[model samples]
Target: MNLTVDIGNTRTKIAVFNGEQFVCEEKFEEAAPQHLLDMVALYSPDKLAYCSVGSGQPAFETALQKLSCPVLHVTGETPAPVTVHYRTPHTLGADRLAAVVGAITLQPETDLLVIDAGTCITYDLVDAAGNYLGGNISPGVEMRLEALHTRTARLPRTEADGETPDLGYDTETAIRAGVVRGIGYELQGCIRHWQKRYPTLRIFLTGGNRYAFSNAVRQNILTDSHLVARGLNHLLEMLP
Candidate 1:
């Protein structure tokens, strides 16, 4: 068994992988490292790996020190099997790197497009030949609303859940429709453009906002919100 942890920009995901299959998974808004340690003991995995893109590493490190298992924390500098070709490899987010690793692991020798719709929507590209080509980031649903409210004068702050309006009638509904549909269209456009360049592109969507898109008409999208953690486990298997 292996414990896989992904400390994302917004949330922390912990997974217990029993040979490439997750037995159980847990989520946290802010990672309580002690809870992670307890979880590790509960799972009793001999190996642990984590993807840290935030400041939760200290607690993770502290927990690892006391654990009997070996914890491998992945970073841009950390040794990975895949070669990263981002212009500034060091500046690349761990989540992006992990996503790429996850994409390639899904199927090798395939052109991959990863769309992570969390606080900010990120679109990353990897060639069938295996080079990581960079991506685009745009404000997501919540960010779009927050930016409008915080930056502008009158837009009200809104949350996404409990009966999302399919059509915009008034202010809040209009904002919701615009943000949601705008992202849907934007993601589709980007995928279309990228697909034209690489005829067969595998599209995978991850991150929190995946639920916003689970249904409601997407042409060729494969979603697994737990992709990052799954990818971390995949990377661990390739390790020496």
Candidate 2:
């Protein structure tokens, strides 16, 4: 069995996998030592892999070291299942690379476009031969909404919720519609442009706000909220 941990800007996810099969998963506001110890006691995993974008807790790392299992802390320089062709490999986000690896693991030897809608919406591509080509990053839903409120004086600070009308009836609704629906259009445009180059492109949507944007875009996409965790598990398999 393998234990995978992904620490994001907002939350941390822990997953247990038996080979390619996912056993269970959990989420925490923070990655604490006790949380990892509890999971270790329950799963008894022989191997562990973790990736962190934030400044991780030292105690958590110590806890992982104490465990009998060999732990692999994934970084931008980590050996991945796919060959990365990005110019600045060292500057690449760990989550972005992990998502690309997870996409390839889920569907090997296929052209893929992975869109992760979390704190920031990231788009990454992998060729059929498993080359990790770089993609773009854009402000996420909440970020956009907050930007409007903070940057401008009149725009109210609104949360993205409820239905977003095509044409908003009032100010709050208009902001909601513009922020939410605009993102949907942006996603569709990106998908269309990419598809023109790669006709057989497969799309994978994952992250916190996946459902919010997935419903807006018109495309055949596979959604997996645990893509990063799954990728960490795949990375564990590649380690020597």
Candidate 3:
């Protein structure tokens, strides 16, 4: 068995895999290291691959050190199946790269657009030849709503899980619709543009907010919440 941990900006996801087969996954808003330690003790996985884009948790790091199983810390420089082509490779987020790796793992030798709608929405591109061409990041649905409320005076703070119709009726609905639909439009435009370039581009959507925009975006988008975890495990599989 292989264990993969992704400490994202908003939450931490832990997944267990029996080789390439996914077994189970758990998500925590603020991960308790003891709980993770307990899981490690229970699973006794062959390896644990860890990736983080959030603030460092000393407790978790300390706990990781005590674990007997090998823990692989995934970084931008981590050796994966794909070759990253970016000017500032170190600046690239591991989640983004992992998503690309996950896409390739699911559909090898195919042009892919991996979109992760987490704390931030990332759109990463990978060629059919397994090259990570880089991607763009945008504020997530919640972040957009929070920004509007915090930055402005009158606009009320809206949640992503509200009544988001084609057009909003009231202030709250307006904010919700605008933020959600705006992302929909963004996805459509981006997908269309990319499709023009890569005619057979396959779109993969992951992250917490993926379902929120599933209906909004009018495209054939494949979604898997455990994409990053899967990629992390794949990275572990590639290790010498």
| Models, CA RMSD each | 2.0, 1.3, 1.1
Assess each prediction's global lDDT (C-alpha) against the native: 0.79, 0.89, 0.88
Question: Could you arrange the candidates by lDDT from highest to lowest?
Answer: 2, 3, 1
- TM-scores for all candidates: the values are 0.91, 0.95, 0.97
Candidate 2: give the clashing pairs: none
Question: Judged by TM-score, which candidate is best?
Answer: 3
Task: Kindly list the per-residue Cα lDDT of model 2 for residues 1-240, writing each as its tens digit.
Answer: 999988888888899999978888999998788899999999899899988887757888888878898999888778987888889988888888888888888889999999999989999998898888899999998899999999998899998997688999999899999988998898999999999989999999999999988777657799999889889899998877
Model 3 weakest lDDT span, ten residues long = 211-220
Write down the lDDT that model 2 would get.
0.89
User: How many residue pairs clash (N, CA or C atoms closer than 3 angstroms) in each of the candidate models, in the order given?
Assistant: 0, 0, 0
Off by over 4 Å in 1: 162-167
Clashing pairs in 1: none
TM-score between candidate 2 and the true structure: 0.95
lDDT of 3: 0.88
Model 2 collision count? 0
